[model samples]
Target: MTARVGVVTFPGSLDDRDAVRAVRIAGAEPVPLWHADADLKGVDAVVLPGGFSYGDYLRCGAIARFAPVMGELVPAARSGALPVLGICNGFQVLCESHLLPGALTRNRSLHFINREQRLRVESAGTAWTGRYTAGEEITVVLKSGEGRYTADAATLDELERSGRVVVRYTGGAPNGSDRDIAGIANEHGNVVGLMPHPEHAVEALTGPSEDGLGFFTSVLAHLAGTVPAGADRSG
Candidate 1:
């Protein structure tokens, strides 16, 4: 059976459709979940796609954290019953929701950076990154204003110690993120958040490499009980 993947759509979600398409391309059944609903409908995993929700007021992910949908995401993630992946603005929401560590601040230049960028897979044990090898480099689109990630030094130390920093910019910092962190994961590896838009780079005609396909495929690979052999981060 195809793994059921849930993609949540909030009022201002811009990439929900693309996220669903990416899920479908990864060979999963994409379930459309609403931001207002309190149920997951029994999905095996979920993806919070990018977009400016609640107008990024009071912080990007702050308002979405209280959405009824998250009411189901937090504890489910804690118990490992369901896996959650947040992309771009969704990453901000995940952090604000306390599902992941650190906070996203305004980009270092205070300008939105929209371009294809290179990143390295820094961790392999996350719900969304199992298909990648440690230290792998991949190209994906980066577009956001509040993309800088900040955390207390102690938390950064903890993440480094526990191998939780999942993805980092390979060629220096893009947004002045502490440690060039592009993505991070929770302790159980069931939750992941990243600033780049992986869903945007799945097709080769899109200029940026098709390296982003692994993001969605990783979840499916996990469900299939097969670790991808070609997903080496050293590339």
Candidate 2:
């Protein structure tokens, strides 16, 4: 059976459709999930696309973390039964929900940033990165205001030591993120949060390159148990 990937649509979400399209292009079935719904509908994976959920009130993703859908998503993802990818504002949500560590703060420049970005794959063993090779470089769209990923020094060190730092910005830090970190994964590598909008880079005609397609395909491969040899599938 084709893998079913859920693309969640929270209020004010702007990239949910792009996420659904990316999933479909990657050969998986896209299931639309609403923030108010508590059920996951048995999807193999989930994507929280970028957007200003709840008008970015209180704080970016702070309010959306309490969404009814997250009530179900949090536990399942914690158990490593569900692979979740959070992009941009979605990344903020994951951090706010405590599904992933660290918080996304305002850009150091204190301005919204939108541009094509270069990133290096730091760990390709995760469920969402299996299609990539460690050290490979790719270009994807980066657009956000609160995009700086910050964590306590100890937490940041631990993330690096555990090989959970999924990707790092190449060239220079666009948002002044510590250590040029652009994305990270949970200890199990099942949950990944990226500051860039990978869904927007899945198609060459629209994106900087087709580099972002690997993320969706990687999850599908994880579900099918057909990831490349030597892949870490513990998640």
Best by lDDT: 2
Off by over 4 Å in 2: 228-235
Clashing pairs in 2: none
RMSD to native for every prediction? 2.8, 2.0
Instruction: Please state the error at residue 51 of candidate 1 in Å.
Output: 0.5
Report lDDT per candidate.
Answer: 0.86, 0.91
Residue 52 local lDDT, model 2: 97
Off by over 4 Å in 1: 227-235
lDDT of 1 by residue, 128-216 (tens): 77777787899889999999999999999998888888889877777899999998887777788999988988887753877888889
Model 1: which residue pairs collide? 136-233, 136-234
Worst 10 residues of 1 by lDDT: 226-235
Per-model TM-score, in order, reads: 0.94, 0.96
